[model samples]
Target: MFLAFGFVMMLAGFHAESDEEHKVAANTAMVLSGVYAVLILLVYFAQATAVRLDSLGDEALRIIDYKRLGLFFSYDLLGYGVMSLATFFIGLTINAKSRSDKWLKGLLMVHGAFFIGCFLTPMLGVFNSKQSGVDWIGTLILEVWCCYFLPICILSYLHFANKSNK
Candidate 1:
């Protein structure tokens, strides 16, 4: 996911270079996307290493717990929310030149809604504990998001590839 995001950021920077008018927007998008990547990676590392250590006490374990709703989970959610914002900004920077480009732009911008949901839902405290039903709903939403996002990634690749050929 981090690699994929880096690719997207690179493309955004490329677009910024091509269009002087939207350079600031594109740069801002890349910066936000970079933050998202860093945050996610740190959370992943913490989950894999710090969370798994036996030397850690019970209290510490609870704070870093990845199995149920906990601090790390919230961090993960926050990272994704930031990512959605980055995608929204990236969408703003785009000057669509083709059908695929238009779809990509629209999808990226629309994905920003995820930030609102993710940011707000945690505050509601519904995910404080592992509820099977609520967890499934969250999973379903992410799956649906992936379905929407994958096409945008493909279209972005095609758009950039075509541009390079010209």
Candidate 2:
């Protein structure tokens, strides 16, 4: 994901009319993507090291320190939210140059909405219950939003970039 976005930024940098805009966009994209990549790596580490909820008794589970898990969630919320907002800004920049790139702009907005929704879920205590069904719903929401929405946004951005380059 970071690589794809980085590539888009590189292309955008090359095409950007002003040196300042190119530098800003290129640097911002790289840093935002890098932060997200690191956050994903940290999530993997947390998953590997954290005790499974299923392995503990109810009393033990209640006593389990959730600080690390909370940190993981916080990191995900911040990283994804920031990345989504950055992508929205990038989309706006692209749209400014190419008024015909409506689909890309719309897709970026949708992607931003999903990330915003995900960020709000924890705050709303949507996942506070430990029901498997609720967990599954949360997972499904994330999968659909991130896996489907982001890929489509990237594709639409690329399509517009290609068309504009021609």
Candidate 3:
């Protein structure tokens, strides 16, 4: 969840370095990043607090339960979708003069495509696990996400660190 906050800061840094032609896209990224952060924060906080209600009926509990692919899970996925949009815009704002920056830019743009799954997953109700509270598909998706993002993060770190040196 803290990734939401860091994602905003990452967008901010991108905005800070953006050229005049890219500022509009960078600004859009920043706004979307904020929305992403708020949505995720609300979902997580509710999971930590409100969803813990002792008096909730079984049906209501099912809706709020973090264990199931319920309403809150939908909201969480939506939040990530918004984050994907933010990163897409961030990618648009990059000029990508270096190879690292070029890879970062491409990765950010590709990452945005995750929004499609995030959108359709809830509506289609396609993902399921054989065991309760153990979503293997979700786990697989997350593993894929982490694997894809590793290069992006590494490239971004190198890009900024090299920038600071110059």
Best by the lDDT measure: 3
* TM-scores vs. true structure, each candidate: 0.83, 0.58, 0.87
Worst 10 residues of 2 by lDDT: 60-69
Winner of 2 and 3 under lDDT:
3
| TM accuracy, model 1 | 0.83
Q: Rank by lDDT, descending?
A: 3, 1, 2
Alpha carbon lDDT of each predicted model: 0.74, 0.54, 0.83
lDDT string for model 2 (1-166, tens) is 3444454554455335325545665456556656666666565555555555246555543433333224455556656766665565555445334443566556655555655765676677655545544535535655765675556546655665776899
Among residues 3 or more apart in sequence or in different chains, the pairs in candidate 3 whose N, CA or C atoms overlap within 3 Å are none
TM match of model 3 to true structure: 0.87
* Alpha-carbon runs more than 4 Å astray in model 1: 4-18, 51-56, 130-138
Provide the RMSD of all predictions against the true structure, rounded to 1 decimal: 2.5, 5.8, 2.5
lDDT of 3 by residue, 90-128 (tens): 999888888889999999998999888888888887644
Ranking by TM-score: 3, 1, 2
Answer with 2 or 3, whichever has the higher TM-score.
3
Predicted candidate 3: what Cα RMSD to the true structure?
A: 2.5
Candidate 3 achieves a global lDDT of 0.83
